[model samples]
Target chain A: GAGVSQSPSNKVTEKGKDVELRCDPISGHTALYWYRQSLGQGLEFLIYFQGNSAPDKSGLPSDRFSAERTGGSVSTLTIQRTQQEDSAVYLCASSAPGSNQPQHFGDGTRLSIL
Target chain B: ELKVEQNPLFLSMQEGKNYTIYCNYSTTSDRLYWYRQDPGKSLESLFVLLSNGAVKQEGRLMASLDTKARLSTLHITAAVHDLSATYFCAATQRAGGTSYGKLTFGQGTILTVHP
Candidate 1:
């Protein structure tokens, strides 16, 4: 695809189950970011990946949230023991060269915990 | 920590009307960004302001930055129904000349346009 891509556009999991969300950035784009948006709400930062370096995991809400980027391309965000509050849309975006550039986003994955 | 705030959480306007959205941040940043998100969709990049005096305009939207005030604004000119969406302002933290572009976003301004 010509733009950022995310997988499992919708997910419904048991309250205690775990879930993984995937992202594929645009080819050659070096920056990736993850964010969460509750229904009718704004986005909350999650994490960011620059090039192949260690990702900045600062925005992660808790220890149960983790993410990994391989070969500077694709990333996976994992959430453990999901709670009802984890219900939200997880968004992925990628930018070229620098972070100051415009970011192209993928259709977010809507996760619902029951 | 950087704190960002936006006002007029919701705005309803008719086509051809104009409005402005404000974004304020707590700390100094290297750049500011504006994005748009439609219903149940991901964000769409709208603008990037690199410096205090930076201003960028496209179509019906114009975005400006003021590092001194730690503020940014997105202005709409002759708005249309297609312009309805949630608008977000983001700031990037930087140390030295290099920045990782980890953006902290403000609560979005929701615009409703009726034609």
Candidate 2:
């Protein structure tokens, strides 16, 4: 893809249900990131992936949150036993191989837990 | 830990007025990025400042970075109604390895330009 792509542009689920958000990064982009934006709040980093492995998962809010990237192209963020507080916009971003490269963001998946 | 703060959480100005949004960070950073987001839309990258005195401008918007003071500023010149949106400043730390490319973002400034 020419830019980062995210699936399930909007998802609304009942509390305690699980949800999965997907991201397809730009072709050949070696660095991928996940971020969460709550209503009217700043973005919070969730995880960072370099290639097929994640070097930093420190930002994951809880054990219920897990993410994985395959083939260094697509990634998935899964929230297990979702709570109402999990309602937010899940954004995916991809950058070129360097740390200084600007990240290109996806449209994001707006998750609403009811 | 890296922390970023943006001031003037909300700005309402006339179409021709000028304003500046300020961003301050608590620690040294490798780079600073400015992004704009319209309501219910994704973020759009505006500028990337890599050095202490770097400056970049596009159209009516200009961004500058001052690493010595851990600050960055986005200045709007003769603002227009089309420029109404939320602006965010993000900083990436100098740490390499797994922490690379991780951004710490400010609370963002919401700008509204009325005619």
* Superposed model 1: Cα runs more than 4 Å off: B95-97
In model 1, pairs of residues that clash are none
DockQ of each model vs. true complex: 0.69, 0.64
Q: Pairing residues by index, what is the TM-score of model 1?
A: 0.93
Scored against the true structure, residue A53 in model 2 reaches a CA lDDT of 87
Docking class of 1: medium
* Model 2 pairs in collision: none
Candidate 2 C-alpha error for residue A111, in Å: 0.6
Q: Which lDDT tens digits does candidate 1 get at residues A1-113? A: 58888999999999999999999999999888898888555678788888766447777989999999999999999999999988999999888885467778899899999
**Global lDDT for candidate 1?**
0.86
lDDT by residue for model 2 over A2-113, one digit each (tens)? 7899999999999999999999999999999999999766699999988888888988989999999999889999999999999999999999876567899999999999
For model 2, the local distance difference test gives 0.92
TM-score of 2: 0.96
Interface RMSD of each: 1.8, 2.2
